[model samples]
Target: MRSTAHTDPVLTQSGCSSTAVRALQISIAADKALVAEVRHTVRTALESWGASVIADDMAVVASELASNALKHAGSEASVRLRLSEGQALLEVDDSSMQRPVARRVGAEVEEGRGLFLVQALAAEWGWRYREDGGKTVWASLPVPAGSAA
Candidate 1:
């Protein structure tokens, strides 16, 4: 969380850390509108980093993670973005300690493919569980040099 009285950017979490070139964080409700905001924030931030080519894919990743958090982890999830060292990372922190499982094409569902979509778009994706029980799912993609346009 950031504590800005007026003009100071608090950029570090107690134990949460990252190697992103630049980053942003937001607390979102378990609502679709809030999820949309996450999507937009990611697109704009990546665009600022000259990685606009991946904006749409980034937005899709955000929506997938946010929706999964709402559906499986409740409404207390936070979204974070990190753009560092030629890479863009998206993370969703949620109260649920349950690790996400990758669903097979017909594992036993009619339509459940959130994680699958993420895997397809992200260059790499993974998760880590906090000592206190919360979990963070992160995905990363390369940032192209001429992506901004």
Candidate 2:
């Protein structure tokens, strides 16, 4: 559960407060066994950011994204958390170019509803290709009003 956090000087220089932007990046293994670790990491990060109000939702979103990377990309991934101005941005980087698609799942199905759950939980979600090779799927979850930013 290694993670790193730092202040973005650029944002601060641009008039945002020092605590306005905080970020954490954690490396995720390609193995599905690590899904629980990833969820734990997300929970800890959100708690440390004083945004525990959204921890459960963010944790589920992170798990889904990490599982997708392991199932589809079959390669190591990285999870990044960016918290700023009452919003939390969760991103998972994986070595796959295949865009994520939301598939409809019947009640009896036991699989294939990762993106659907993400869409239903996240305030906004999308993906983009990385120049080096791979893609990053991201979700934005707003911190509940009144939670410390």
Candidate 3:
């Protein structure tokens, strides 16, 4: 969290932003304590940008992806949010290249539901292996109607 905030910087964690595409990013340690911080940060930024309608959805997506990285990958992760077209694109990058699988669990089960929640909340979601040997999972949620970027 101490790394420079580029408006929120880094070629790795943040792509910065211009008038054309609004973006903010933060690099997080594997510590579980920071997941809640990520959620709050994302929501606050969206509200400030007039995208509060999707803040909850993006926050949920952010926490789930970040948790997945922490639990399974056991490494630091980066969370980035951007306004693309009319959707809020949230991406989480971690050191693991292993793709996430959305498992089907019984209703009685409590675990393995993170991606399931993400799928239901996001407009669309997927993961890609990066050239740097890590992987990034991303979700795009629709912006609230009439919200400015």
For model 3, the superposed segments whose C-alpha errors exceed 4 Å read 3-20
Model 2 spans > 4 angstroms off:
7-17
State the TM-score for model 1: 0.78
Query: C-alpha displacement of 85 in model 3, angstroms?
Result: 3.0
Worst 10 residues of 1 by lDDT: 1-10
* lDDT tens digits, residue span 1-149, model 1: 22111112334565465333466777877675677777777787777767888889988998899878877887668888777656778888889988999877876776579899999999999999988888999999888765532
Error of 2 at 60 (Å): 0.2
lDDT of 3 by residue, 2-23 (tens): 3223332224334564343567
Q: What is the lDDT of residue 30 in candidate 3?
A: 81
Best-matching candidate per TM-score: 2
Per-model lDDT: 0.77, 0.88, 0.83
lDDT of 2 by residue, 1-149 (tens): 46787756334555755555778888876779889988998888789878999898999999999999989999888999888878999999999999999988899999999898999999999999999999999999998777945
Q: Which 10-residue window in model 2 sums to the lowest lDDT? A: 9-18
lDDT of 2: 0.88
